[model samples]
Target: MKNILLGVMLLLAMASFAQPDTAKWVRAFPVTDYMVDISDSIRLVQVELPEGTSFKEKQLGLLKGIYRDAQQDTGTIGYGRCHLIKGHYYYFTINHKQSGRKPKAEDLLYTMMDSKPVYNGAITKLASHFIGLQEVGGSALYDRYQVFLAWTKTDENNVIDSIVSDINYTGSYFLQSDAAMNQQIKSGRFAGKGVLDVMMATGKDEVFKFLEYMAIKPNLYAGHEWKVAEIFATWLVSGAPAVIKE
Candidate 1:
């Protein structure tokens, strides 16, 4: 009896040790390499604001100034960049157009206009709500042409809940294809288990948190009609589990 109990305990311990980490969760994506590029860019730009300036204040001022300058010079809307001073440490990608190219600093200075008070007010509300939920560490990206906003993981549980609730209430668009892309990886027989295994090994909680965020709204990326699943499949076939070949 004693021997059997000891064996059972050992088995359980082994299983726990075998569980994948959070990094593995991210690795489960077949298109992880490409996704890595995007993720890396996001990570690189993540920032936290200074104590005195609020995220809302910085965003509003930056947007107003940039928009005003752009209108005066080009007589059109353009992309801009804003830095938040509190909570999260990151830069935001403000859209002026549909192209994925980076906007010029000059353009960033031109998006601050007083003409669209109503629109600007709504934007302020939405931006502040999202920033409020973000962990002290996360980033946001705004698609100018589509008027869409997307965010990454943060460390605060309360902020996470706020972000999720706000997105649901606001009916904001998100990157649905990213979730679908991850789902496809999980659906595969051989690769699915492996991906989950890796994610569990890396950061299970973080991976699940990201998954939950994606499950919240209609995917804005879906409008592009790009078959992210297909892209993921091809990437998997070529090479997956970036840390390990095959």
Candidate 2:
């Protein structure tokens, strides 16, 4: 009887050691029908700021989420798919009359007002929010007219919650890592050597504290619409400000 008891105790101890570290696969998406393990293809861990968290804790949390994808990036040179900051987006659209023919470089006017310096220092304003640029249309001889520009706003100080949403992106994780990596590689050298892509290949998805994914909202003519997309004035960058050239 004593020997039986000892065997049962040993089994219990081993089982306890093998238990999962978490109860849920992740918090972004929860399983209702069945339980999910951490090894599942779609796993997310959502962390809520406790009610009593201090200001320092909040700052630390921001820093952690910003650098979550850079675990392997040793250099102080910070870079990532989303180098967020505190700022607000100031929306604008520069509409020029393009009769029928494709516009020349100068045809891309920045303002409609002549009474005052409507577009004074507009290039600097545009550059402030510029994240990157891409040629989206097909053919150099034909439909290639407009370029897409992305940037974060730098006018107001705001947090992540005010910026991103699930409508944009969920910080692709779980089993979607393969698809994400494939898309990155397809972008050629631009993303072939991206820091986020490498992290995805190794199954390292970061917990998005507030925002996820970003894209430029272009007009039908592939130009900036009358509205401007807003972002905060302050942001976190892995490196220097990025410039998107035409």
Candidate achieving the largest TM-score = 2
**Model 2, span 156-224: residue lDDT tens:** 112122122211232234226545432232232233443333322321121121011122211111222
For each candidate in turn, the TM-score is 0.18, 0.20
- TM-score, cand. 1: 0.18
Instruction: Give Cα-based local distance difference scores for all models.
Output: 0.27, 0.20
Q: Which ten contiguous residues of candidate 2 have the minimum total lDDT? A: 23-32
lDDT tens readout by residue for model 1, 13-95: 32122122121100000000111122312211222333332233333212111222233432222222344433544354343
The alpha-carbon root-mean-square deviation between model 2 and the true structure, to one decimal in Å, is 27.1
TM-score of 2: 0.20
The regions of model 2 sitting more than 4 angstroms off are 1-169, 173-182, 186-246
